[model samples]
Target chain A: EDQVTQSPEALRLQEGESSSLNCSYTVSGLRGLFWYRQDPGKGPEFLFTLYSAGEEKEKERLKATLTKKESFLHITAPKPEDSATYLCAVPFTSGTYKYIFGTGTRLKVLA
Target chain B: DVKVTQSSRYLVKRTGEKVFLECVQDMDHENMFWYRQDPGLGLRLIYFSYDVKMKEKGDIPEGYSVSREKKERFSLILESASTNQTSMYLCASTQVNQPQHFGDGTRLSIL
Candidate 1:
């Protein structure tokens, strides 16, 4: 069975602080790994996708890095507007058109 | 931009009533997905349609059914709503093996 687990269910950070969130997974034949940000009362917004190990993608203050068994979403100098639930998901080779998602990490950045 | 539109943002209905949640995508994507988001469960896929008149079951499809009469529209049907079915429903559309675009989501509450 494919499973995804995210660490630090909640994180509170001060302005200009830096941190990283972990997303570990166990699946067969990973096709893609995705990162999304979701605010309260809204749907998730796409952020980045990593397709292979040692791959990294960046956007503004966020950088996503992928490894064989895990992925990390690194935030540098976060702001209040960056506070949201960060989710990670992986597409498997089972041809289900489905993604296995993590429980997500709620980030709260104080200004 | 790919815009996915959900029919409602907030809805309340009786437990035994039948419910319909509609979604439309203007990007003419070939894949449409239905998912329910809970507090601790992240997002669980309920159903998805690859093309017009073709549907596939996801991880949780026991209490849900879907319809795709056209390429841009997909509907989720609840034959008999239950208290356990109250959740934040999300709709998404994408091309094959591409990033997904999401709607604003519908928060459904069953009385």
Candidate 2:
């Protein structure tokens, strides 16, 4: 069975502090890994997509890296505005067009 | 900008009532999906459509049905609302190998 799991269900960091969030998966085959940020009372916003091992993508203060077993979302010097639930998702299979999503890591950056 | 729009931001209904949640994407994406999100559970797909009039059941499709009468529109229907079904409903759209774009979401409540 294909499944996704995230670590440190919640994290609290002071403004300008840096941290990393983990997403691990178990499946027969790998397709793609994705990252999303969701604010309270809102839907998720797409962040990055990683296709293969050692692949990395970056946006603003966030960076995402992927490996065979897991992916990491690294936040560098984050701000209070970046406080949100970070989600990890992957396409189930090539043709299925469905995704297996992790439970998400809720990050709170205090001012 | 790729924009996915949901018809409602919040909804309230009674148990045993039929409910419909509609989504439209302006990006001309070939794939559209319906997912129900809950805290600690992440996003669970209820259905997805690859093209007009084409639909596929997702991991949690019980008590739910979907329609994609056009390329840009997808709808999720609950045959009968239940308290347990109340959740944050999300709509997403994507093209081949592209990152999925999401709408603001619909928060549904059943009483």
Best by lDDT: 1
| Model 1, residue A72: C-alpha shift (Å) | 1.1
Which candidate tops DockQ? 2
Off by over 4 Å in 1: none
Off by over 4 Å in 2: none
Clashing pairs in 1: none
What TM-score against the true chain A does chain A of each candidate get?
0.97, 0.95
TM-score of 2: 0.94
The models' CA-based lDDT, in order, is 0.93, 0.91
